[model samples]
Target: MGTEARRAGRRDFAGLWASYGLSNLGDGLVVIMLPLTALTLTSSPGLVAGVRWAQTMPYVLCTLAIGVLIDRVERSRLIRWAHLARVVALVLFALALSGEVAPLVALYTVAFLLGTAELVADLGTTSVLPMMVERNRLDGANSRLESTRSSLNEFVGPPLGGFLVAVGTVFATLSTAGLYLVAAGALLLLGRRYDPRPAGESAPAAKPRIRDELTEGLRYLRGHRLLRNLALMVCVMAAAWSGWSAVLVLYAVSPGPMGLSGTTYGILLTALALGGVLGSLVAGPVRRLLGTRNLLAVDVITGVIMLATPVFTAQPWPVGAATFLGGVGSGLWNVTVVTLRQQLIPDELLGRVSSASRLIGWGGMPLGAAVAGVLAQTVGPRPVFALGAVACAALLIPFLRVIREDTIRAAVASRDTRGE
Candidate 1:
């Protein structure tokens, strides 16, 4: 029976995995296209920065509500709906771009709407994973998913998006919309029975109060020492990453800075994706070899590279190398952190807790982007990058002090024992 169950689980997981890959590729294409589209509309760094900020803003404002929704509704259905929403947004955006000039306001509005849908899809997909596989195999499953995301979204999609945008923005965006439609279609295969109600919850005994449900998720995170601290550390790291990334495209491609052409910039971006691919592949073995503590410690290498990039080199090759190394660290860090969160959180509370945690962790992204934009305009891109690296380095102190390797291992072991 156990063997049969595992086989069934693998089959289900494969469907979910494919859906994720298709959606992520579309997401990757948009990631490149959106900013470039904004640049074409306006040359103002702050205005261009708004494009990134608008996309991330939904996480801060809507994730808590979405988290509550995920807990109550069918997750697969929610994901499908979210993908459909994105398709609508993308189609509208492509229409807006069909003219000689795409309006900045339209770009911002579309970006925000797309981001709102993404928040739901991302949360649902992640929370749905444990249901598809046995708990023990979560790390491997997450690593595989992360690797796929990096490869398709980061590696293939960016270059393709750049090429498409170079040829024509409207065509690229319409193609991305088509991809989202495909992703939505893929989710239909998960079937109606995929999301069962949480354990101990009675059927439709009046709609649960939103405030109460929201509080439960927050209170759970507050009470759990590891989760609470981890969320905070993640917030800091996210801010640093966002700050650097907000200004990165302009810094790399503009004639004043690195001066690389669109295709070359896309190639440089691929170097980061390639490093992520390598990191995801090695994350498991490296974690086992180095132990959890050292594996996490290695993440600081990314901050170090960010710091060095501005001071040591302005040339594309050297900067690309730095981004590659940072991507490697990011890949390993994501697999480790995500797997740990999955192992620790209760299955029922997973959706709410994941959203709550992300609210804290990812909430800083918009703020960072806004700040970086202002700073870039004021102090220039190099200084903004330098400041971001310093912030990243400072975050390590709290990260190390709060997260103990033995505690994490013990928690996982306890969960396993309880499951048995």
Candidate 2:
């Protein structure tokens, strides 16, 4: 398509992008603020880890149900509602924090509810994307979204969150709530055409049983070889990332480890986001240069860097460098995997399949976080990080052996021939 046509095509996408960026900014702030707030409530590592677990637990519990809902309703409307729900959750959280500390139960409750909204919003927004852009442009579209997310949520959001926390916890919480409201407003600007009903289904039909719909999604994922394999890989990757991330605040800020202050910790986290930005910029060219098969293997590089983070160095600069490199690999992997899924899955089944896949892939995260917390208490944060890295690296062996470029290409070609 020409530049003008592409730009025109992106008109709806611009709204989606802006909404996601705004929401991600709030997410970015919460990433640091939430855990820090949890720490103030209690010093226990397991309880602190529970905060991360709460944020991810909904993926396992609610994703399948959400998948069914997304396919049946207007996805844009669902997204708007999710963001508005998030706004309420954050506002309540801010209110709960009127004192110097919040109750642990309250923190977990808000975290879980916010995560529930996030899961629905993510599923709806992702499913809506292929409808808005050409199939061939999936890579570019995803790259743009990831880049914006990284820049706003990761890069700008973290440090800003840290600063806000330093200034006042209530201020940070309220600011995050305001951002979610803005995100909801931006999503409302999307055109009516954004939500396309599932194929072979009319608007006025009797509601299908949720269990049957959930089973259909599960069966579709179970039957697809490529998707099944990819989901397994995602599961391992999420586990590894979450395991290390669960205790990362303690490792980074506590006097016994890296011994960094809040401001420095935020700056350090920004290194990872900055690397993600670079990775987004390079993903297209790297895909072209490396071919799909090799491109998929980039996670091995990420795994290595992750392993190096705790085992190889305790110094801040080296840790930051490793994080940056890992972020790059993560960026490439996201673009490749998401584009591949978009190409291969039928639009009618996209929401279901995406949710099912994530149910397996992202489901590992909460378990990993909980486990990492326990392990950190028993062993130490460093060993937990090391173990997580090892698991990540080992998981790659099956992926490298099973997934070939020819098979992936053939699958996409076959889907295209069928007009999926």
Candidate 3:
């Protein structure tokens, strides 16, 4: 029965992954198209930046409630609804672009709704991970999902998106909307029908109140020294990494081998995409061989590469090298952290906990982007890149004590072993 259950889980996970990958590819296109659309409609950098602000600010403010929603409802239904919401938002975006109706406001509203929906989807997916597979396969499942995301969404998504945008905004956006609707349909038709645990196993006698659930997740996270320290480390690293990437256009525009026209910028984006593909492919083995802690240690080399890019006087190679290495580090880091969260959190509270988890980590993304803008304007583009590298290097140190070899080994073992 355990073996049969494990096989079923794998089958279900494969279907889920396919649906996610397709939708994620659409997301990749949307990221590029939306920014380009904004730039076309309004050439102001401030407005462009404001769009980013609208997208990120809500995650910090609204994720706790989203967490509650994920936990309190049937996750599969919530997942389907979130995708449906995205479908509507994307279609609205398509209409606004085609009709030029309420243009900027429509675009901003769409970005806001999509952002909110993404948080819900993210929370649901992370929370449901443990329920989707035998605990023992968590690392492998995470690695596969992360790799696909990096390879398809990061590597392939942008270039495809850029090409579609060049073809025309209306076509690109409408195509993306089509993808979202397809994903929604897939979720409805193909998702798992089995309950997380056996039937008649009774719900917990007293369902924790929403406030209590929220507090419990927070308190548990706080008391778990490993999770607490690792979360903090990730937040700092992500802040710096996000800030640097936010200003990538500025770096490319500066004099260097990396510098190029808009077309060249697309090429560089593709390069980063390819590098992410390579990273995702290798991240699992790297984690297994080095352990998560050692992987983090080795990742510091990439951080140094990123920092040193700014100090060099030469062109493209320096910047390109930094970007590639950073992408690799980020890919590995994502797989490790996401797997850790799924393993650590209990099944019922998974959604809320995962949502609360992101509230701290992803909450700072916009601030990081905003800071990059200010730093670029005030100091210089090179200084901003240098700062990001420094921040990545510093953030890893605190996490070392928590993500030791034993911790990683235990995490992997627990997730991989099927319980009878």
CA lDDT, every prediction?
0.83, 0.84, 0.70
Residue 246's lDDT in candidate 3 = 57
Per-residue lDDT for 1-420 in model 2, tens only? 567756756888999999999999988998898888887778888888889999999989999999998887788888989999988887787777885344678789888998899889888877888988898788899999888878887899989998999998889989999999999999767765554565555666587687888988889889889889989888888887888788888888866489988778888889879878888878899989998778778866676676557766779988998888887887788777888888888777788999999999999999899888898888878887888788877876787888888888888888889985
- Give the TM-score (vs. native) of candidate 1: 0.96
Candidate 3 has what TM-score? 0.88
Q: lDDT (0-100) at residue 29 of candidate 1?
A: 90
lDDT for model 1, please: 0.83
User: Evaluated with lDDT, which candidate comes out highest?
Assistant: 2
> What tens digits encode model 1's per-residue C-alpha lDDT throughout 256-347?
47887766777878877888888888899999999877787787767568555955578887888888888898889888888888888877
Tens digits of per-residue lDDT for model 3, 162-188? 788888888988888787777767666
lDDT of 3 at 38: 72
Instruction: Give the Cα-based TM-score of candidate 2 against the true structure.
Output: 0.96
- Candidate 3 local Cα displacement, residue 146, angstroms: 1.0
